[model samples]
Target: MVAQRSPVDLTDRRALLARQPDDPTVLAEAQRLKEVALLDFGIRDSVVASWLYTKCHHHIPTTAVETAAVVATGDGSCLLLYNPQFFVDIGLAGVRFVLFHEARHLMHRHLYAEQELRADPLFHLAAEVSINHVAMVRLQVTGLPSRVVPGKDAGTSHEPVGVDPREVHQRYADDLRDQGREPLSYEEFVDTDLVVYRELKRMRTPLVMPVGLCIHADHVGRHGSEFPADAETVGLIIGEALAEAIRAALRGNRLARDEVLNLIDRSEGGGDRLTRMWGNLGAAALRGETPRTRRVDWWKRWLADTLASKLREGERLVYPKKQGAVLLALGHDPMLSRRGRERTKVVLIALDTSGSMPDEVVDWVTTLVGQTDGVESHWLSFDGVVMPFVPGERVYGGGGTNFQNVVDYAEGRLAIDGVPFEVQPDAVIMVTDGYAPHVTPAQPDRWIWLITNGGDDWPEHHHPPMACHRVTTGDR
Candidate 1:
């Protein structure tokens, strides 16, 4: 039997990236490729902005870059953290390769798992989509920007949708499979040979990559005993132990039953998928972070808004600083020196209780909030009107949630006494079913909504400036 990995040392996974040091040239190239991709594509740099790999040869049980992917998954969307540690085999080519791969995962909406995601067809499309996002971007940044992105889903009215994976033929990806040169991820580039010529190559390091990624942000006691489980090297290690998890799961697939039997067999796995899905998606969801160089408040507001904004339009949280510290608390000698300038915030639960609010859902909301720290919140229940209540304060109303009441209550000093709007809140955390006709004008900068879920679809123009996360009351 393969060893069970000594019960996972959470500290050890972190130590893997703990500074050993890397060549200056490899480091420079990775950042360079990223900036080039951004400038070229008009693709917002804020989306998966920078990446780095560990500088040393550390065996990451999995075949991935050696730094954790910083993200805003808790808010309901996909964002990426490209590793900066480089393995220069060909200049930044490998860096570009991985970026393209991960980008495919983002643009194509694989992160949600909100919908059914098959393994191949959409996966293949993700690869092609990135290639196209890059090709169009190159022309835009290097020379004249492209009026049209040559990508598969460029300039579409709706966000790009997922394609059926099983339908995708294998030849598409098989054609680009390593070309027998060895996995490109193992190398990095430092030189530029041809504008479009043959001698293009980068240098290589032994190996370095990241592992044990948690989709949601980890606050105080969310994970509980499983809080720091050692899934790191979980899928990373390549030993028989690693292969064992892989083999066991794959073995379950060996006896391909008929579609009817397979459909019936998926009940538990389906429930688990749902459980794994929005467990943190209730009223307490958040995207935590540290302060930036200066513009502290703006940075915090950006972090909050990005975290809470309705990500359907492509919102992403990109951390310029190191990933580990991004989620650390801010206190003395904290990440940012200007605390006042950078507003720190507590979460607010803005429930639309106008005639729109039903008693059952209200109890549900209170139950969810009760699960966590109750002090970090202010409750506003409104319908064709608005009323802000303190934690435990009681009030009632039922009618159309006049689109402006909740916003009015949240912004005015009435709800939160003595708190200035600027230094006011970090996030609004609206709990609505999206039935409201409209939303309040966002405070130029604030996380207006962190966890937005009710029972209906948001009106087209009713969306707020902040991230609008959607959660449902029923079964997944």
Candidate 2:
């Protein structure tokens, strides 16, 4: 029989940590165990695990933690804490499982940094389930040692630890069947973190999370106010790390390549947010597709094609007497002039500026228009009235939206700040949320409407509809 350990005193954990450094041998053992865990990560070909482990500060803090836990430092690094005595009890395989488990928690936090999602208790349980499932499969562990019991022969039974995702899924499946509903397979049940949470919520009585199982439960609060640092930047860092791992794996590292490929397969089509996040990581290898195919943002491409068609040169060409030498050399007459052929297309870009447009969308539009050659760009930031401003200039707006004012300005029917748009524009592009009154433009064909996500798409359904496309601002 295994000897039962005394209840851990949470209050004295700090005092124990304060005296931890005094024990050199215990600290050395902890370091060795960490190295062994890294080796296991290598064996499993987990690039994310290896990268995350490198960024973590391993400490054998004499805390009451039964096994191990990882905590984000809010500065793009994490702390990996373990009890040295616990390592001796559970042995090497258990230590490897715990370390991998902790690393995955950090990745989960980085990937799904939304405050609302992280706050949901069901979501937290789902994350635990997903991480544990992946760890078990990758590490080839049928079970983990129990922390509640400890002795010379403790944890040798190989019984699974904590809340098993498969068992919970099975319980959910059984309940759904009783209700005459279909249950997801074990593979589908553990697809993504949110999928698990959403499916579990459908249950009449969702599984409750047992206490003292998840170590970082307290860290995720209702508002995520605990983590004040920029979560997006941290997420970007994690993405870059994944990209490097993928590249390393591609360079003949079989283990890393297989592990990352599995992660990619499991996380495919998670949602637009996840897609955008992974897109930035140069994750072509993950998708098993080329970069060209992935860069195809439908709306952006449509907008580009529309602009190209609108600004296309007229059939008429003027021959310049002085610059016709090149044309003459090509067996063409000197009558071919470059002056009229190179017609500068006039484009007026109007922003709604109702404090509803995303800054990222604005930046993307500005960059797109600024880079095009042979186009005269005119920028207008409008709320109730139109304000003509140069590109890259900041325009503050908090007033009501008025579509008529923008149309009037673009049509040369109005002037602002002694700047009159006397020249007829070849194309007028409007970026808005479609929350204002509908006004017909003088030339609706030349007008292109790019509506932001969640905006009213009135133009799309309008009688004699205008060119319109929804800009998918994924996760921005």
Candidate 3:
């Protein structure tokens, strides 16, 4: 049992309207509790939850709800709404469970948004049961979280209000057995949120009443005018947090990877956007297999996304065609000139032509750079010398690979076809077998290396490391 303040004291309707906490002591206590829980999450390998909490605004609003929740702020952000007295009532352990539970709820919302499922009370209960189960296992807590009894003394009347998956499964088994139907085994029953919902819905008698108390179980007017948040805004905020978590995991954070894989597994029910985003962005790398069968390889998708980010790093201004038309209509000079000449990004692609390079790799690179809207691509094949070549044109090199020669030409120390390399490339992509000695580029940050199979990735180990990945060819 955990100690908590009595909710009976704030039962009056007028008190709910006071959005801000008047007492500094109560506010400080709540903040202290949240900080401790956050620390615990960091130490316990709950990276996604911890990261999400850090990105959100923690608000101690005087609301009628007893527990905390993650809600949107009407803007393009989210906040964790908690009650100070509720935080003080639940001990540190309980606070941790509640906070984690709320964070998981936000993730669940982002993963599943089907209207039919949202409308199903049984499905909502299933979500609560599933989330609470994960929380208990991850937090290593044997007992379910207890809610503060409204009319009782501070610590004497705590009741277990958290949903128990085993209990629900048993009830489901009994109901299905009575109707001469077979119930799924315990393992299958609690496999995932959507799976649990499907099993629960198969029961002869629907669980009309909720087994325990869950704030989300009551979907009626819960986030009314009191909380000015919409599902879409909150979903976007959580999505951004999830993306950051994935990036951290890809950067070799073991704890972060564990949490992200767990999240990706649970969000298996999301639609195409989720599938494409999760599949292409390191999920396959983390799971050791691509998420789904697709025509485009995961590494190719990764390269395209990486290139987009590097090329779109700087700012560019558009003329705003509508603005010019309006100005001309007002009898003023339209001034329809380009505002930013930096719109066209310059990119250099250097292919190592010493050995037989994969045609598929070159073709893919050509398609990506060609399809891009505003780009000026410089193609070159280098062996002992750098030779400027056009896309789809066969350029051969046989003697030996020299990375320094390519670098010299790119940095203007050497000339190709009597043309000085005047412009600074926004991005330089090097595709090679990685057999040559490594040379540092003038702007190492602007370089991306794609090493062939069984090739050295020395650039990744270089100081101030550049972007690097191993390109897998189907028929090399």
Candidate 4:
């Protein structure tokens, strides 16, 4: 874990960065790690033409992961240079935090939205002080799918982040070609109600609303997730408004001020915890003891314990399981085709028919069919003969087992069925007692050989990109 730091500003990075490291060796390692992170996220930063994005066809200069700051290209498609050394020196979690922070920039569409909102909404509320939380929330929700790059079939471009900040500058100039507009200063961004409401200034009294909110059914299926940051930002503003409204109601004799405060405190719990506090604040207000105005400190506590909790629970309504990348690809195209189109996915799982195998493995292999789990597992269990593992259009029943027939069957089907339909097999996971062939894929690009070494006849080539592993039926 990394020590949490104060909020940061990357734009004036020079002032933000206290010192710089100059070791060339450190810079090299930083660059390598940055490349791995980029690939893990599915970002392609190459000079080759993909027949995909036209703007990405040109040369992409080597990205420097060590610079505190660097240059950008004109088209917004190249990294040009960076100082990865700053990130490495900070430690990995620090790097992860920084990467996560930078990811928000790419995911939120902040560049474009900031330009539009600054030019429009800030004028509506004169002298506004923060980034427009309401607009930011709306944009993030609208753009979630667009930014995440669910899969190749999602049709979203896997563009490099900040190919060039200079392009951002150029875009700004182009957008301002009509000189009639004005950009809001950064001061207007940080001080606005967006920030103040979040921290709470108690311009009014707090409410007695319930501590808990209901969650959607779909949300329960996915993990309990926090609300989107932008949405949390909006919630703070609204919560502050609600607090002020409650104070108004009490002062106007709608309710006893102490009774309301008691209700709020009681909301922390119910039965006995709430029995005593209702007459405190409300009674004082009735006797004209104190005027209602914003109390920044009271709000700070309320916001963190109350409204802030709501913000964290925002995505409880999102239903992440249904919203993930798997379904996105299944529901769309280019990545999958039933008949014959572009690329086809063929799934083959190897089963060890060895004497050491257990019954549970057989049960699992049998039930997961019809491609419900997004795969048609071709299972081959080898005792001596190459018994058919995963029966395809070619067979209906499970038979004997043979180690060598596993590859033979796959190559045959791929050459036959795939050739006729013009599709290709992308993945093949072999779940077996590692007694099979020691041969590697001549066409290594199409296969992922995972040797589930049940009986310990270990195979050698199980390292990476091409994954190899052993799994017992007892251990998941």
Candidate 5:
């Protein structure tokens, strides 16, 4: 069973608060230490450190807590809590390490956000190990000096505190080797948060996490347990901060750049979430050799442009009769006019419901089309048959392809339950694998074909070329 720390008692908290010094000198020194840490962060990893400072509010609340911690305020901002006495005890290097450690915890929280993963004891241990390891390496510190207790001897042995990633890896390696299994290298052992958890779970006897080490550990009755509602927003903020650090590093911030790049290198296993976030953030510095900073997916950009163009309102200006008096006074012709266009564009989206279509593509397309404004969407999931669906409704099918059924429905030749499709759609977007025979639509110019991978694309080679673009699945 995992060891848990008892919650801070109210009486003890009150006592601790009462003993906290109100001396100007001590408070001033605490503020100076915080500033010094920030300056050091700017010198080491300029962009991210600066970004973190802006998002987090620093407080030196009187508490019995030994070290510093970071907690979310339920708003977009975070709190960096420290005890002035603790700072005095750990010295300047420890202060820097603790500050960096807390910042990394926030970063870890932003990255590995799945609730299942967060609840795992092993995963929590792995995260602490990884964060501490990164903090030690970046700050050039081997170990944290143990905090002094009031009743403890002054000259007692100063054992290093907190979990060490290397030690944890060694434990796993020894356990695996004794079981006649191959061991992963230290680098591979702690590669990702999930990897660490998975490997540790495989062991019959995994190392137990010590209590009172990780401040963010989700034990019962923990203080400052509230997390923000907008995790994506927090993640984006962190990403933007990392991006700024990368830019600063490129512009001659050597120490800052190196630190930022090292952190990025260590964070390799975040999968597509990390890739999509970092890919567009001018991450050439992270790659070391690649000078091509930004790498955005072309298809997404194209799709955005297409959607914008299609949804744009056709413009025509007219003078209102009420403004005629003002216009005449300004020596303009008194012509009561107005600007207007057709009602919301009716878009028929036909999904080829053959078993070959990817579900992810379908979901993405549906969400995109559904969310668009000034457009009335009519969804149809078709195989050899066509079935009409309302927005936010599920479409289930497994049949052969039939493009004619979609056209017939859009052209009002077919009716469902005695209700004909009376509205002539302004645009018809058909998402298909392009394996079936293609029939000419009634409005060929308004037809947009999004062909999937490895599917036959006949429209591209048709006698009169139509609006055809490959719909990228992004699976590759």
Candidate 6:
């Protein structure tokens, strides 16, 4: 069995948090509270959250946040920040609720990144409503955690508590009605997070503004801070976590199954990032058991995620101290400081281009590479010989397939059209029918093989196996 990692030491991670309380007692108490909440999750039926809490770094007594928030760190990992007094005031129940809410927020941010929806204050409110609604129902809490307000009852904050989805829906309905527009039913409104956002967009004025109440709302704009948390980094981290959760669920872990299902049901929507990741996950974990309607051609997603991992390996990314300080202060993830040349990641796509290869496959590859940011892509069409080409420009190759020629050109042993292939790619993707005799590249680990529908997957059975997946026309 693989050894489980020990929980990260908070002292080591505390440096990541800006403006941490100088008082050691306050820090220790906050750590105790955080540990208690995490322990509660472990003992309860929240394996996913428990696992996530263990995976993420945590900092206590952070003045950057009023309550708690999860932000991506500069190192492509996530950090949870919380105010010590807030946790102390809220008690254990509130601590649990807020932690769960922040966990859900991290998941939400990972799943969706639409600029328009993120920019809309209503959407942020809608997200809070949906997240809090789930947290309330799952945790069996009737009311939100409140802190003491001056001139009021000791556990009563005068600030509006807006956790209930139904209450938010009622307010939205009233506003829409006043504007002479129809409103969706509460059930319909709460179908999914995206659905809530879409319905909220119909309203002329939102009853609850999420600006000061939520961290995401406060840090939505650049305002001297470009969206921190490298999108790729967050995507990779969350994808791995979900993939692990899915594996645990599939292995008959009841709690894991329930949490995974809840996440997929509540957060997933058409054409979303999570949808693609889930498709690849379900396909891999469930194999042929996935339903037709939900079955997507997961190869593209699988390939994309695979390429990302391979390319990111062994790369040290850091941010400027000044910029990182500002990002941490705002509860935002700091991006790595890299020059334009250093920022560009190279990928090479080698198409078999034999008669067996389909047009759709090539088009899919073209679109995938073209859409990726900071990726300098090189294209090659290989038959018996290899020829360099660019996307959208057709190259003729009808001869027999030979994998060695492509590998030769990639490793700088062979030249194409008398010009030596000098660009060293971070990863190489070879799309072919896999009919040719397999020859090993110098670095087979850097290579990925895509076999066509009727093609053989020789790479998988090779002496040193390579990452190989079948390319389909579309969804099966």
**CA lDDT scores, all candidates in order:** 0.33, 0.68, 0.72, 0.32, 0.65, 0.69
lDDT of 1 by residue, 123-181 (tens): 23333333333423422223111121236475332221112111221222232353434
- Between candidates 5 and 6, the one scoring higher on TM-score is 6
TM-score of each: 0.37, 0.52, 0.63, 0.28, 0.53, 0.55
Give the backbone clash total of model 1. Answer: 61
Residue 443 CA displacement from its true place in model 4, Å: 2.9
Error of 5 at 441 (Å): 58
Cα deviation at 95, candidate 5, in Å, is 1.2
- List, residue by residue over 387-430, the lDDT tens digit for candidate 3: 89898687989878899987887888887668878888888999
| Candidate 5 lDDT by residue in tens digits, 1-476 | 23334345322334435545577676556666765666567545344655575555335445544456554444565555567866766666777777787777766663346777776667778887777777777777777656555555864545555788888988988898889998888877766666777888877587777776755563332353332224654565576567556655654577757867776676666666665555555464245542323444434544444554455434312235567678768985444122467578888888887867776667777777777777888888888889888756877788888998888889999987788899998778888888888788767767777888777678767756656667663432
- List the candidate numbers ranked by lDDT, top first: 3, 6, 2, 5, 1, 4
lDDT, residue 296, model 6? 64
Between the candidate structures 3 and 4, which one is better when assessed by lDDT?
3
**Candidate 4, run of 10 with poorest lDDT:** 213-222
Per-residue lDDT value at 304 in model 2: 68
Candidate 4, lDDT over the whole model: 0.32
Show pairs that collide, candidate 5.
Answer: 318-337, 318-338, 319-337
lDDT of model number 3: 0.72
lDDT winner = 3
Error of 6 at 247 (Å): 1.7
Off by over 4 Å in 6: 1-18, 22-25, 58-60, 110-112, 150-162, 176-182, 208-210, 220-223, 283-288, 291-476
Clashing pairs in 6: none
Preferred candidate (TM-score higher): 2 or 4? 2
Model 2 worst lDDT run, 10 consecutive residues: 1-10
- Displacement of residue 84 (Cα, Å) in model 6 is 0.9
The most accurate candidate by TM-score is 3
Q: On residues 31-99, what C-alpha lDDT tens digit does candidate 2 reach at each position?
A: 666665665564453667766655443344664455666544455554556778666555677777777
In model 2, state the lDDT of residue 75. 57
Cα lDDT tens digits, model 6, 1-476, are 11122123222355436566677777766766776677566556466566666556444457545666665665767776687866766667778888888777767773365777655666777788888888887787777776566667764654433456777888889989998888888877888777887888787874556445655455432233422455666666666667656655754577777788877667545555555556667633443354344556667766776776565433322235798679879985444333233557788899887766777778888888888777899999888888888787878889888888888888888986688778777789999888888798888878888888888998988978888888863454
- In the predicted model 2, the residue pairs found to clash are 45-255, 319-336, 319-337, 320-337
| RMSD in Å for model 2 | 19.5
